[model samples]
Target: FRGRRGDTVKILWADADGLCLFTKRLEEGQFIWPAVRDGKVSITRSQLAMLLDKLDWRQPKTSSRNSLTML
Candidate 1:
């Protein structure tokens, strides 16, 4: 998500032993990062999880029953 248009994503990790680098490329489509941030470099783990689930992590979900109104 280095502000480039592509499917490949690079991940860098460092542990006590050594550094690890990982990459994931989708066959189609692209992973989108938000453009509304004031100044942010990376997202939290929870945010990443929500993105992976195709949900908006920054907000709460509301449930409403339309059947009751119909009744």
Candidate 2:
């Protein structure tokens, strides 16, 4: 995943007999990221898919209105 400033992320995994590396970058826009904290965060499969598509995984739909109203 790339940060807001275009920082790229590299993922490494070990297979049966060797290691593999994968990377992805968006030509435009940034991946939706969780709040910065001490530990790691978890995301659902659908969220991951949305992220890969360069969409905001945090929100289900971009045009949806906020349910909360200001008093």
Candidate 3:
């Protein structure tokens, strides 16, 4: 999905209603593409959410702090 359609992405999957198609386009910059396998690209539901948020869905990062306690 490059060139004139670089900003757009399409997701196809099967659900209870049978087949479904989702299309989205970013206002600026193109969506980061995932690796393709056998001519197809795939990602998890969580990854999809991260992708939509303009985060690196391939390996999303989160900040964490270790708890300091004395028992």
- lDDT tens string, model 2, 4-62? 47534455669899988878776666667656556665667887677667777777785
Top of the candidates by lDDT? 3
> Superposing every Cα of model 1 onto the true structure, what RMSD results?
6.4
Q: Which consecutive 10 residues in model 2 have the weakest lDDT in total? A: 1-10
User: What are the clashing pairs of model 3?
Assistant: none
Considering only N, C-alpha and C atoms within 3 Å, which residue pairs clash in candidate 2? Answer: none
- State which candidate has the highest TM-score: 3
Runs in model 3 lying further than 4 Å from the true structure: 1-5, 63-71
| Model 2 TM-score relative to the real fold | 0.56
Model 1 stretches with alpha carbons more than 4 Å out = 1-3, 36-40, 51-71
Cα distance off (Å), candidate 3, residue 67: 10
lDDT of each: 0.62, 0.66, 0.73
In candidate 3, where is summed lDDT lowest over 10 consecutive residues? 1-10
TM-score ranking from best to worst? 3, 2, 1
lDDT of 1 at 30: 65
